[model samples]
Target: MQVLATAGHAAHGKSSLVRALTGMEPKEPGPALTGTAWTRLPSGRRVAFVDVPGDPRSVPAVLAGLAPAPAVLLAVAADEGWMPQSREHLEAAVALGVRSGVLAITRADVADPGIALRQARERLAGTPLAAAEAVAVSTVTGTGTAELAAALDRLTGRLPVPDPDAPVRLWVDHAFTAGRQSVVSGTLGAGTVRVDDELVLMPAGTRVRVRTIGCAGEPRDEVGGVSRVVLTLRDAGPVAPGMALVAPGRWSPTTSVDVRTRFGEASGRLARRMTLHIGAAAVRVGLRPLGPDTARLTLNARLALHVGDTGVLRDPDRRAIAGVSVLDVRPPTLVRRGAGAARARELASWPDRPDGALVLRRHGVLRRAELTGMGCAVPPDAVPLNGDWVADPAHWETLRDRLAAETARHAAERPGAPGLPLETVRLRLGLPARELVAALARPPLRIEGGDQLAGGQPEPEADGLQ
Candidate 1:
């Protein structure tokens, strides 16, 4: 089903328009009584309509509905033209990546729609919906309702289908108890859930069994992503609206995250405390600046997060401050003095592929198998050092060069001093680990006996030094 959210200013006839579009048929399935509704097209296609409040104060609700819907129906009042709330809603929609939508000019009977249409186009100019189709309609007189429906069909028809095999994340927007069973409803993001499948509730590791799944008021054995689902859970405990039902062992709930952030056009330097909204969860967090556009957020509650999930950060006053892109869900603690700067560098150099090269580059050396266990692909060019350790090719070369120079200097200064003690060479290079020293023991530099390093040419007097 294609989900279309109605976004516009308050009193713009958004809810009235959705009722008109869906005919408010009590017999129809889906969320017809609330802000969300659904209707069947002539082609027998069902399109879900999410009617968002037009008031600026309702921005959070609009954002919550927009999280799972890919398309929108931006409603504009014919007489009022584009209000301040309209612009804010549009900006929020665009920032949230809702680009596909149609413009609905309601209450056209009260004013000439030609002027409103022109004004709507002007407001949408240079925005994501610059080319969106606009139509004038009246719920009372029913003017242009057919055109609006056709436009909605076109928009929903063009929406991309959700992948069923992807990772599953269902953002719970509503939770209640029904007949001794706990019910939760939301748009499933990916993967499929079947009856009797155990789903893990995030932030708290509570596992609940799926008793039944319903869509459009019909029971189903399984449901896939990109669809609205109402789930009745068995043996569940205190289910709530900000929680998520996810496949077990696939995600981790984390309190601290390192993110790449982009400040909004109206955003200022973020405050120490802010509200972070991801999926349907909103929680306060402490912001630690890692860079100008990056931060380490310490969430008040753990959230089941993954890399690439986009969230919005708002100040305590509920003003949007920045858009956050998850770079690392499991961020390291900035415990040391310069760890923040060092962490920034490490995240800056993160590669697209989890190839062990970046990890090795950052850590100097790691156990080959351990790198793979961290979801890193060991590059084919990587060479094995010692028994199970691996070192990046380039890093090992640099280490080799530094060790040769340091060893040669130590030998030259002492004339015939026994090849520098392995411990001394290790200490001089500032590498405290024996594995780090072993990584530099490749060709052109040899370990003399078991305790000394021969940098360049070996002296005859130094042969028996060990």
Candidate 2:
């Protein structure tokens, strides 16, 4: 299935265009409860259309549509040209990594769409959507809707398929009870869910069974990601919009995360109060800046998330204020002064390819299984230190340099002293364990008596000095 979210100013014909393109009539009583519409392609492939309200106050809704949809249909009105909501929605889509999109100049019959198309082209220049094609469309007259559909088809073909074997992390957008079962609907982004699969509800950690699965309103035995899914649960606890349904025992919920963000033209530290929108969930949060593009978020409640999830940090008004790429889903707390800088340094040194080197640098040491638990690859050249901890070459060099300088200084201050006490050395270097210090002492330095390091080759143990 292919999904394209429609974003534009209110009354710019987004809903009308969707109805005209999909042939799916809007629910007569009101907008659909999920605020989404669907259609089928000639190839029997399904296409779902999510309409993001153009009102600025509905930024959260807009972000929800942008995050899950592989592509977006940014609508502009021929008569209204480009509006503030249009720019806001486009920026949000880009922030959330929407790379493929089409510019729909709606209501072409009302005015010269040439002007609107030109303005959109100029506005999108140098942005992620700069390459997007502009299609003049009018729902009333049914002009160019077919061409827009073709564009969506081509765009959907370019999206990379999610791994069907990965852990399922469905972001629940809506939940309700039907007959004797509880049903939850969401856009499944990864893995597959089958009937009788035991799933874990995150943040609350409740277990439930999938009695049945539905896709595009039809019953199915199994459903893979990159499609809108509806799961009927055997036992449903207090599930809500912001919670997630994940693979059993594969994920954990956390109240804080560390991330690197791109704030665009908006500058200054993030406001104390902001909202973080990831997938379909939005939560109020506290922001602590670690650097220009780095921060630590303290979420109001825990969320089931991963290390690489893309999130958007919005201002108090819920506008797209910053785009965040999560670095660490479970980060240590900052309790003392200068802790922020220390954390920032760690983030700066975080390896692009998370590996044994990163684990060794971050925690200074780790068990073999701990490295595997973090999904770090053990490099072929990795050298083991102590029992199970691996030593990063760079970190080892830094430790060696510091030890050499400190030892030299200690000997110079107290001429004829054997060496610095191991405990004193540990305290001076802020090392957590004596084992770490012992692991660092190599050639040119010797540890003796289990408590002292020989500063200058042990002075040959002057005869009978005892």
Candidate 3:
């Protein structure tokens, strides 16, 4: 199954287009109706249309609809070629990285769709949807609807294949009680979800089991990525919008993140406070600019975020929106005078994709599992030292040299004392475990006994009298 969201101004036939394509009446516009409508095209491919409201007040709902969708069905009315909400919706789509879609000139029977199509193309120029196919449709006369459907079929066919085995991160756009059970629905961005799979709810960390799975209004044993899904959950306490269900033990819910702007320079110009909209979740955040294109966001609440996650930052006071790409979820604190600028320099060197080696280089050493939990993909060739701990080769060499120098100093300070206690050496070197000290021991530095380390040749034992 494929999913596409409807983005356009209100009363611009967004709902009418959905009704024509899916043959189902859209639910009243709200945060809960993000991905409720579905249809199957002539090519035998199932597609779900998320009809989002275009009201300026409902910008959050529009963001929720576009967050997880891979493509869009951008609607523009012939009579009203382009509008304010149309630009806003298009900006939201570009911010969320939506690249595949169809431009539908709706209500063509009332006016010349040629003008609307040309206007939309002019606005879409240089955006991800710049080359999107356009179809002029008139639901009143049932004209061009078939062509629109065919265009959508082609759009879905061109969508990038999703990884079914990737980690699941389903953003809950709607949650409600069905009879005695709790039901939640959202678009599955990646990975597959099964009936008995256990998932952890983000920001709350509540564990829940999937009692049932439904997709496209039909019950199923499991469903894969890039599809709209409904799950009846057990132990789903306080499930609501803006929360996410992710693979248990695989995500880190963080309150602070470093991001790169997709729209414009964020340095010293954006509001100090803004609301971050990502995957149906919206939360207040404090912004601290790190560079012209980079900034740190301190969210009011924790969010299960990863590297490369895209979202929009809206300044409520000015109603300004900026697209952001998350760079680091576990960002370092900027308490020193020049730390922020130095961090900006560091971030400037980072690639858009997650890099485990880069993470290890920054921290010196980290547990392999901790790195992965931070949404980093640990390289297969990474060598682990002292069990799960992986150290950067250069950092580890520096630590080894420091260890040798510290051991020699300890021996020189106490000529007759047993070489520094293993725990003491570990503490002096700021090593997390004493095992690392042993791992760092070289030819001249060796463990004297089970609990002590010797830095030099051992003193000769006094010969005993016969």
TM-score of candidate 2 against the unseen true structure: 0.78
Residues 216-262, model 1: lDDT tens digits: 66799998867777898876878777788887756657888777764
RMSD for all candidates, in order, please.
6.9, 6.5, 5.0
Which one wins by TM-score: 2 or 3?
3
lDDT of 2: 0.76
TM-score per candidate, chains pooled: 0.75, 0.78, 0.93
lDDT of 2 by residue, 34-92 (tens): 36677875556677877667777677767876788788888999999989988888888
| RMSD over all Cα atoms, model 3 | 5.0
Prediction 1 global C-alpha lDDT: 0.74
lDDT of each: 0.74, 0.76, 0.86
* Candidate 2 Cα RMSD (Å): 6.5
Ranking by lDDT: 3, 2, 1
Candidate 1 ranges with C-alpha deviation above 4 Å: 25-34, 178-180, 263-268, 316-318, 342-466
